[model samples]
Target chain A: MISQLFFLLLTSVAIYVFAKNLAKIRRNILLGKDIQLNDNKAKRWQTMIKVAFGQSKMAVRPVPFILHLIVYVGFVLINIEVLEILIDGLFGTHRVLSFLGPVYHMAIGFFEILAFGVLVACILFLARRYILKIARFQSPELSGKPNKDAATILLVEIILMAALLTMNAADQLLQSRGAEHYINAGAFPISSWLAAPLFVSFNNDTLVLIERASWWFHIIGIFAFMNYLPFSKHFHIIMAFPNTFYSNLKAKGELNNMASVTQEVKLMLDPTTSTPEGYAPPTSFGVKDVQDLTWKNLLDAYTCTECGRCTSSCPQNITGKLLSPRKIVMDVRDRLEEVGKNIDANNGSFADDGKNLHSYISEEELWACNTCNACVEACPININPMEIIVEMRRYKVMEQSSAPTSLNNMFNNLENNQAPWQFSPMDRANWTLEG
Target chain B: MSDFRVKTMAEVAASGEEAEILFWVGCAGSFDERAQKITKAIAKILHHAGIKFAILGTEEACTGDPAKRAGNEFLFQMMAMQNITTLNMYGIKKIVTGCPHCFNTLKNEYPELGGNYEVLHHTTLINQLLQTGKLSIRGGAFKGQRITYHDSCYLGRANDIYEAPREIIEKLDAALVEMKRSRTNGLCCGAGGAQMFKDAENGKKEVNLERADDMLETQPKVVAAACPFCMTMLRDGVKHHNKEHEIEVKDLAELVANAMEL
Candidate 1:
């Protein structure tokens, strides 16, 4: 009864904290403008399955691809065991799914193998990030807390897998001894073979204590990790599915035109319609703040894994330019969090603190993009960082009127001559001669 | 040279005739001397194929690709509205252009501005003609010559058109070689996104020079491109490397035109 009461209290606290953070994140994402993405349900489903579930784009690099596949498969399959763990924790039962007999043995046996795979993958990942010091991991944007956050997630995963194996080992030993309250449950072929020697000398009572300690540690660690996701780049684990589903389905180069501006242009061009009475031009043109972007853009920010694949493939970054696509996504996410916190502090309404995305993302970084879509193509989860960069640039040019001198000249020429060049419209046909 | 009569939309309208397509002579094709050669070569191919085509002539304005890319939305909308009105007045349907920037903007973006047309890149049209036997290439000059095709970013990745230009090159009976970064993985030619209008930002190496190095690594006798912006950037990069005299940079239409001896 005491164990069940403790379990209920711990589970309640964990659920409350996790749900609160998730709700906050949802609200922050909802702060952006609405974008209708309901069309083409079939295509969106296909994209989510292929890109996020199948990990199709991640296969471009063979080494990381295989390692990521192992971790991904292991994480997904191991969660089935987590479901059993949850049942056992709630009811103070011992391997509740063991009632399925042989099928239960096979399921536990499969999860044990995957748990081993997860352990090995986490170690390899740690070595790749810290020991091997891959260039992408060492990018300037990931130097501080981002780098530590990644390492912490990996380290915590390693601990969780270790605790799982340890718990299984002790449970197996206790089961062999026919200890009370610890029945002959769970088939641990891998852990038994590996962990038998470590626990052979220990007695049944001590084995029960070891099993209980590891069980508690693993569950608490998982709960803590679940809550940590809202603050970490590992949030992609949950967001990648929705982000891939809502991805832009048009041609990669197609820019999203502002509907209000498009309507204004149409009115100006229409020969039959004149301006409405008391017409007022828009106060702002492009995305100057988080509110100016679409919900999809904000979701993209929260979904970024900060893997630096986008930055690694960016032409501007390759050529030593200021733009790093990963940083662009990260900055948007940071700004969104800042804005979310501000709203929380001000009685459910945000008071302007005079800070925007531009405070972190500089003008040089915005102008350095080639709009080549390389970053979009390289993103394993279909994150379009270039879209954010272009939106910010639209703000700079349209709202601020601070485009580069050459661009200003080009705009002037385009307004006066109907082309980017400074030449008469009649001269457009001067290159041609009669046959 | 063939006596190819290029008619303007105005001429066709006055004559009470309709054309099958409109040749959108993009800004580069109209003003840039080298790109003008590509425009003429495309016209030659269209004439040989007996395709009824008319140009917008002086009524043709920019597609607002550069302006839109450079974040000048007001200017882009203004230019797009004017061009859409002109094209609508002519009741134009199918259009083709040799510039990838113009092709991308016209095909993908113009519809949002209320201008919709069946837009095709020149290489796509040429490949279509070859497939239907509307055009034939003898390959008399380019036969067995080693040629490498550069994928323009706007044409290849943005528009997903990797095979059309390659298909055109293969029709020449030439050995088509690929750079290390070709097709969807192709790099930019450094002149996209209105980069052609200004100097490059500070960087260790110019993007075109790096891409030009990729083409040179293939060691082809001819470097072929389908976009005018790519032609200018690759030509400049080739000139920078002093390989202009050794490796000839030609458009796909030029190769097809030469193969047909037009």
Candidate 2:
């Protein structure tokens, strides 16, 4: 009964902390400007199912695809076992779902096999990131905390899977000895084969103690992992669904028009319409800070897994340009977090820090993008870093009037001649008659 | 070079007649020396197919694709509005262009500014002409010749047009070899997003040069491109490698015109 009380207390604290962090992230994402995404509900749901739940995009690279699939399936199936653990812990029952009989055995057997797969996959992933030193994983953007965070998540997963298998192994040994109060439960086809030797020499009492310790460690490790998600790129495990659902469904080359700018241009072009009295134009044209971006853009930043697929496929990055699309998304998320903390410290309003996205993301990086859509196509989660890059470029040109010299010349030619070249519009058809 | 007279939209309107389609002679088609051959080839194809087409002539302004891509939205709007007004005045319902940038802007971007028309890229139109029996190819000029097509970024990845150019190439009776990166996974020619106007930023290598390497890997006699920008960049890259004598860069329309022996 005392142990049940302790389990309840621990579970409650974990839930409270996780809910608090989730609320904080929600508030941070909401700080951006409003944009409607209510169109095409059916398509959005289909995209969520196919891209996020189905893991369709990850299939491009087959090796990582299969490994990631194993870990993904294991993560989802193990949560079913977590439900049973919660019930058993809270009610002081041994194998609470043993009443399900044969179905319970199938469930336990499946969970053990998946646990083994997750363990093997996580170890291989760690080697790929650390020992093999894949170029994408070792990019400049992932040097410090990002690299450590990735490694830490893999370590946690390995530990959790190990504890689960160890617990099942100990339980199987106890069941075989016909130990009292330890009901003969679960079909440990995998763990019984792989981990049974580790606990075979232990007596009944010691086996019970080992099983209880493994259970506590597994449950505690999960709680720690749950809290760690919001702080890591592993946040994609939750955010990928909504991100894929809200992905831009238009042609990949389409650029979104600024509503305020479009309205102003329409009014200017309409002969029947005139400027109304006291009508003022918008001061800024595009995104200058996190607040200037739409909610979807902010959500994209939060959803980035920092896998560098986009960067690896980027023409600019491959050609050794300064632009890494992964870094652009990371900068946005880091800046948003900073602004969120500032607002919290200053009574729900942000004080000017004289810092913005440009402080972290440079002009060189923004200008290097060819708007090729390679980054958007390569992202496993469908995160569009080009959207952020273009928005920042809009801010650079319209808000600051700070385009490069050649672009300024081109802009001038466009204004004067209606073409990017410095030639009169009258000569547009001259080539038809010329050699 | 072909003995065909091009009519202007003004002449058609003054005669109380309308053309079946407007040939949108984009800036490159008008000003660039290399792109003019593509324009003439397209005009020849239309004439041979018995399709009545008219050019906007001097009344047409730029589609402002470069301006919009280079972050000059105001300039882009001004140019787009002028062109839209002119097109709406003439009641032009169908348009065709050889440039993907102009095609993309007219078909996708101009509709939001009240400029709506059925826009088709030249390769797509040529494929249609062949399919509908409006135009037939002899294919003797390129009989069994090895050719490779470069997918333009604006047309392939942006607009999902992977088959039209390839279909046209197949009609040429040529062996269509594919580069390592082609179709949906094709690499950029490095001249997109208004990059044609500006010098390339510091990089390990030029984007065009990298793409040119991909094309050279196929080792075909001709590099076929549908976009004028792709043509310019690929031609320059071929020149950079001093392979201009060995491999020729031809627009899809030029190849089709050759196959038709027009």
Candidate 3:
């Protein structure tokens, strides 16, 4: 009874803290220009399933992707056992769902196999990071906190799997001795053979103590991992679903038209049209900071898994340009978090920090993008870093008239002769006369 | 070029006749020396295919792709609205373009600004011609020669027109040698997003040089392209490697026109 009370208190606090963090994240994501993404509900759901749930785009690197698939499938299937653990924790019952009889036995046996696979996959991922030192993980963009966050998520999973196997091993020992409250209901395919060596010499009371401690450790570790997600790169595991669902459905080549600028341009064309009654001039053109971007861009930033596939395939990055697409998305998230915390400190309102996104991202980096959309294509989920680049360029050109010298020349020629060059529109048909 | 006469939209409208398609000869196609060759090849194809197409002539302005991409929305809108007015006046229902930038702008960007029409990139049209038997390809000089196609960012990754260009090459009886990065994974030609108009920002190497290396690995006799900007960049890329004399860069229209029995 005492253990059950302790378990309830721990579970409640973990869930409450996670729920609070999630609300803060939701608030941060919504701190952007509002645009409706609710159109084509059927198509959005299809994308969410195919991209987030099915893990379709994760197959670019065959070896790591296959290993990732194993961990993903194992983690998800093992959660069925987590539900059983949850119920047993609350009710102070041992294998409470053992009432399902052989079905329960088969299911627990399957979960043990999965837990072992998850252990192996997590170890390989750790080896990629710390041992083999994969280039993608070693890039400068992932140098400090991001690197540690990845290892933390992997290590936590490894320890949790270890705790699960140990608990099952000790439980099997208790079951053989006919200990009280030890239900010999579920099978242990993995712990029965694999973990038995460690517990062959344990007496009944010692085995019971080991089993109880392992159970408590496993459940507490899971709750801690759940709450740790929002602060880690592992947040992508949740954010990817919403991000893919609200995808930018336009062709990658199409730059979004500014409707406010459209009305102003029409007035420029005719000079006779009266402004509409509800006409409000745009405060600023393009995006200078996080709030200036669309909600979709914010969502894309949060959904970035910090995978360097985008950086690897980028033409500018490949040629050693200053721009890394992964870094662009990361900058947005970092700025958003800073703003969110600033708001928290100031009674739910932001105080000007004398900085914006450009403070972190440079003009040189912004200009380096070819806007190739290779980054968008390479992402496991549909995160668009190019859209942010385009928006920043809009701020640079229209808001500040700050295009590079050569592009200003092109713009000048575009204005004067209606072409990107200093050529005569009158002589457009000159190509026809050429032999 | 002297044997074939091109009709303007004004002439077609004044004659009380309707052409089936409008060929948007983009700024590069109009003024750039290399792009003019691709434009002429497309003109020859349409004329011999017995398709009635007219150019907007002086009435056609820039499609504002570069302006929009460079983040000048007002300037881009002005160009778009100007061209849209001219196209709307001619009652143009369908269009074809040799430059992927203009094709992307006219097809995708113009629709939301009240300019709507069926738009086709030149390669897509040429492939359609071959597939429908409206046109047939005779391999002629290009038969069995090793050729690789360089994907234009605006056409391949931008608009998903990878297969059309490849299919046209297959019709040329040329072996299509793919670079490790081709199609959706294709590298940019350093000409996209108005990068061609400006000097590239500081980097270890020019983007075109990187793309040039992708082409060099294939060791093809010819590098076929679809977009005018890509032709200019790929030509420059090959020249940078001093392989200009050895590796020939030909636009898809040029290849089809040179290989056609007509």
Candidate 4:
């Protein structure tokens, strides 16, 4: 009872905190005007029908697709199992799942088989991510990565599941239980085999105590997963769906027009860019850094699973360009978290006067982009890499007045003759005459 | 300049003028001697069809494509407004031009600036005149010469026009061999997007060269194009690579003119 109470209390607090933080993040994104770009009416129903429920992106890569599907389906259906374990652990009630009809018993039995399939799939995933180091599956470059956190957490999840199955199978087989208690009789093969031997040593009382411990451990494991989620890289599991749903759906190069300069002055100037000459007017331009980036960009950063799928498909990256769209998202996210920590601690104090702003990204990385929409289109999770890159470019061009030297001559020619070429306006007709 | 009166499509078509088509002798047609030959041949073909038309002469300005694509939206807006005023003053309606870039800007981009008019590529107009039995080819077919058509990006992808040019090529006794990347997926001649005004990005070979190489693979005697800009670029590309002697570059109108024994 004490264990059950403790587990409930901890899980409720974790859920509450996570929900509050997610809401705050969403509110911040709305405040940044990220939601205005999406014209959701035309394709909202279609996108919801296709992307949200259809799982199309997963199908793009088949290896991870099958394994992830099994695991995800197992994860969802295991909630009922979790409830059964929680109820039994708290009240000493056996057969908590037997309240359902015979069909429900069969359904639970099928999911038990699926849970075992998930364990096997998890093993394969571990091999693919670690030993083989499948390029797409690996994480982005990290400084001082603990390395053990992922491996340890994954191994713990698998083993805890294995132990719980073993404990359930042992209780069903050796406790002299009747057939009516057979909620998962034809499922969990290896656990059933291990059950017969365990019954030979432990009596009924001992078996009951062992079963109760397994039930308690499984419930506790679930609560622990909830508590550890926000701090873990696995937080994408909770956030990715919503991020993908609200992803940018617009023409490739059509940038959302910035609000007018006069409108900003009327709204009381933000202190971030306040100047000595009264108020530093908000320039209607692109993004320069984390602060300039929209909340959707920040969400994109956090939701990235470090899949490197974008990098693999990028034409510029493949051709030896310094840009990697995936890295841009990761870097933005890492910097945001770092700066967020500073802001939280110092009551919104400046970090080294924003000198560390470009620590994660470089000017070379910014200029190398060809503004190709391939990265964004290839991203199965629906992150708009082009929007962020273009926003940064807008900042570079407008605020810094720093662009390629070639563009200088081009801009000058355009200013003089209304064309990028240095030819006289009279020469525009030369080609037609030559024809 | 005033004496070189530019007549509008409405004036020529509605008034039953001597010319059957109003040839929008684009800026290049009037100034460049080589392109002038194409416009003249087209004029002679229309004369043979007994169709009445007039050239706009120096009244036509640059179509504002270069300004629009180069991020100079304000300049584009200004140029478009100027052209609209000129076009409206002339009472023009139907336009036939040999330049795809001009055709695209007039057809697609001009409407954004509130300039709407019926614009047709010369190849389509010529093909239609021939199909309607209004024009007859004289007894001459250059049967042995193999030819390939280069799909201009503006006419192909930007405007989704591929059939009219192909129909014209088929009607002529020329073999229309396609480049490796053709039609909607056709590459730029490194001339569109206002690139003709500036040198290409460093270290990247000109897009026209890549296209020219594809043309060479076809081993056609003549490489043909519809857009004046594409003709200029492909001709330069063929010459730059020393393949000018191996293959000739001609506009589609020029080829049809030759086929008609004009």
Q: Locate the minimum summed-lDDT window of 10 residues in model 2 chain A.
A: A267-276
lDDT of 3 at A344: 99
Best by the TM-score measure: 3
Model 2 steric clash pairs: none
DockQ for the candidates, in order = 0.64, 0.68, 0.84, 0.12
TM-scores of all candidate predictions against the true structure = 0.97, 0.97, 0.98, 0.67
In terms of lDDT, the poorest run of 10 residues in model 3 chain B is B135-144
- The pairs that clash in candidate 1 are none
Candidate 3 global TM-score:
0.98
For model 1, residues A1-435, the per-residue Cα lDDT tens digits are 798888889889989998999999999999998999989999999999999999999998888898888888988888888888889988888899888998888888888888888889989999999999988898889988998999999999989999999999999888888888887766897889877679989998889889999999998898899889999999999999999999899999788776667767777777566666886767787788887888999999999999898898777788888789999989889999999999999999989999998999897888777888888988999888888878887899988999889888888887888777888888887766823
> lDDT by residue for model 3 over A1-435, one digit each (tens)?
898899899989999999999999999989999998999999999999998999998876898888888888888888888898999999988999899999999998888888999899999999988999887777788988999999899999999999999999999888888899997888998998998778989888889889989998999999999999998889888898999999877788888889989998999999997899998877789999999999899988888889888998899988888899999999999999999999999999999999999898898988888888899889889999999999999999988888899999999999999999999889999888867
Tens digit per residue, CA lDDT, model 3, B1-262: 6787898999999999989999999999999999899999999999989999999988888999999988999999999998888899888899999899999999999999889999999999989988999888764679888999999888988898899999998988889999989998999999888898988877799988899999999999999999888888899999998998999999989999899844
Query: How good is model 4 by TM-score?
Result: 0.67
Which candidate ranks first by lDDT, i.e. highest?
A: 3
Model 3 residue A269 lDDT? 97
lDDT of 4 by residue, A24-61 (tens): 45543333334454567557546644664565776877
TM-score of chain A of 2: 0.97
Clashes of each: 0, 0, 0, 21
First chain TM-score in every candidate?
0.96, 0.97, 0.98, 0.83
Question: Which docking class does model 3 fall in?
Answer: high
